[model samples]
Target: MPAPHLLLVEDEPRMAAFLLAGLEEEGYRVRWVDRGLPALEAVGREPFDAVLLDVRLPDLDGVEVCRRLRLHHPALPILMLTALDAVEDRVRGLRSGADDYLPKPFAFEELLARVEALLRRARTAPALSELTDEPLRLDLTARTCTVGGRPLDLTPREFDLLAYFLARPGQVLSRDEIHRDVWGHDFDRGTNLIDVYVGYVRRKLQEAGCPDRLQTVRGLGYRYVPVSASLHDDTA
Candidate 1:
């Protein structure tokens, strides 16, 4: 197979040079762009396997660029680069359509690993028909959700969380498991990001009139009750 092509959008000349050298050394064909507009133009005119998008760009913020990119290439892998390590920043990047995120001052090896993982996922992602449970439906290929045939608008992270739950219907999933499966990593026990996202998904589900299928397990974690099952009776 040909070497994977990557588009790097970084305004900092030194950082861009460093990444270009590192990625090229790993056998990736790299195209470097310093501004969001040119980056978008480059992608429009060329085929790239993935994009390394800096969160702060010269012409436009990476979040806006990512959002626009998603409108045209929903399945493309976008790895966001940012100096800010705040959880909210990461969440914003993900919601804006980034496939993965790496805070700045990161190890080159770690960046390479993330880029490789994104490429692997993009190439091997499974295709499935709509996953249905009565009034709720999750179309994995289309990346859409609906309840009782009414569309549910969900952020990218919310959609991912729901998809993870639906994939393991009736199984009690610990917060650690959900974190690993959906976010591709583990978080501290004190972190409530998982709960926050679950709340988001739950509210959207309720708004869609899908009932409270996501049940809290008190001491354990949470379980997804399919529409066909009684939410209270299922103990998994």
Candidate 2:
């Protein structure tokens, strides 16, 4: 595919120029707009993988812009940028259809990270249906996870890991495989990150009073044993 296109909507010219230059250096194709109305017009004219929208504009409110985009362009990832840092303001932005939030005076690195994560999340939204075990559904679109009729509170990474495992249920996935599959291939392997995250998953399951569905494959890897199979085998 072509380099991801970003619609950058910030009223300040210098800030918009900085973002455009930085993101272009990172190989993203950016189209910068200085107002909400033109941003909406540009978005309506074509497709973009993600949008960085300023929450305040000279003639239009950013929340309403987000709402309009969401009504018609629901799948497009929208990251809201604002000087407002109040919890209520953040909540309002999210409730108004922003997929991610970034406050002013933010690090450029953090903004890039949020943009990448939002795009990643958007990419996975459509393929989520085929990435889970039956009856234990994970709707990435709805941002809900359910296991055997019980809902689970999972952090984003945990949810991704679980969904990945369920998609390949009964298969022994190595630490490297797990990391490459869920965390991305660029993830550093030197750290014991997979082990730590697995431990987190186990603790969450145990705390939820599960029947111990996750199993260590005797120093090799991990597997998600089905609840029924656990009962009959007794040794898993």
Model 2: per-residue Cα lDDT over 1-236, one tens digit each: 89999999999988989999999999999999988889989988887999999999886678878866764455789999999999999998997779999999899999999999998998878633333454566775555777666888999778777766765667888987776556653478899888788788778777766555677887888998875565688687
Residue 18, candidate 2: Cα error in Å is: 0.9
- Cα error, candidate 2, residue 70 (Å): 0.3
Each prediction's TM-score versus the true structure: 0.55, 0.54
Lowest lDDT sum, 10 consecutive residues, model 2, at 127-136
Query: Scored by CA lDDT, what does every candidate get?
Result: 0.85, 0.80
Q: Which stretches of candidate 1 lie over 4 Å from their true place?
A: 126-236
Q: Which residue pairs does candidate 2 place in steric collision?
A: none
Best by TM-score: 1
